[model samples]
Target: MQSKATTPTEYIHELPDDRKEVITKLRDTILSNLPEGFEETMNYGMLGYVVPHSKYPDGYHCDPKLPLPFINIASQKNHIGFYHMGIYSDPNLLEWFTTEYPKYVSGKLDMGKSCIRFKNMKKIPFELLGELASKMTAEQWIERYESVVKK
Candidate 1:
């Protein structure tokens, strides 16, 4: 669900009690492992980890006024959604995540191009997600983003 909350803290506080802990842990996992250049903010009505304007002045290609988004977490209608741009844009990263997913999660991966859905919150692999978050840095993401967008 899209949250109207303006800040990450507010967003978490607005979630249903059942979801608060999972989202908090997910947010914590991402924050603890993400590279130094990414800044946390509320984006697209979700908790977002972005490469801020200070680090990449050009901002997002779709909307230069906003910072470049790298990752986002949200509580969807029926699942918790974790969106990672790196895994979506980079084929090798996608392959790696797909291959490694089974090691951490017993059930088949429920995923879209960039969004991974966790229906059974108990099965969410925070460590693997953290590792995924750590896989790419802001500079690498910018380079990857530019390459794909420029293509």
Candidate 2:
């Protein structure tokens, strides 16, 4: 569940031992494959990777004071959330995910536009997540987000 933690490290620290492991592994996998330019921080009571205001001074269009959110990882009440902006904004990536995910996960790929709900961490496709993260750069995400806004 979302916590009161203000920092990513604190967020990780707040997790119970089991949750810590799951988030840690996910965090590590994302970090290893995350394209250059995104910065990791805490956002919305979860761990987030964002395009800092320094890169896009206007910041998130919805909230100019905040950085542009790229991806988020949160421990929720019933499950874990792996939020991917890339998939939400890019159809090809979403298609790739839909096509490839069944191979790694045994359960239904419970998901929304961007949030992938994981009932069991073991079902998470680690390598696929890594590849997804690696596919988008901060600039690419910014361009995609801006293009959507323009439309």
The number of the candidate with the highest lDDT is 1
Best by TM-score: 1
Q: lDDT at 134 for candidate 2? A: 95
Total clashes, candidate 1?
Answer: 0
1-151: candidate 1 lDDT, tens digit per residue: 6789999999999989999999999999999999899999999999999999999999998888999999999999999999999998999999999999999989889999999999999999999999999999999999999998534
Tell me each candidate's RMSD, in Å, in order. 0.9, 1.2
Candidates in order have lDDT scores of 0.95, 0.89
Tell me the lDDT of model 2 at 140. Answer: 88
Residue pairs with clashing backbones, model 2: none
List the lowest-lDDT window of 10 residues for candidate 1. Answer: 142-151
Return the TM-score for each candidate structure. Answer: 0.97, 0.96
Off by over 4 Å in 1: none
Q: Candidate 2: where are CA atoms >4 Å away?
A: 149-151
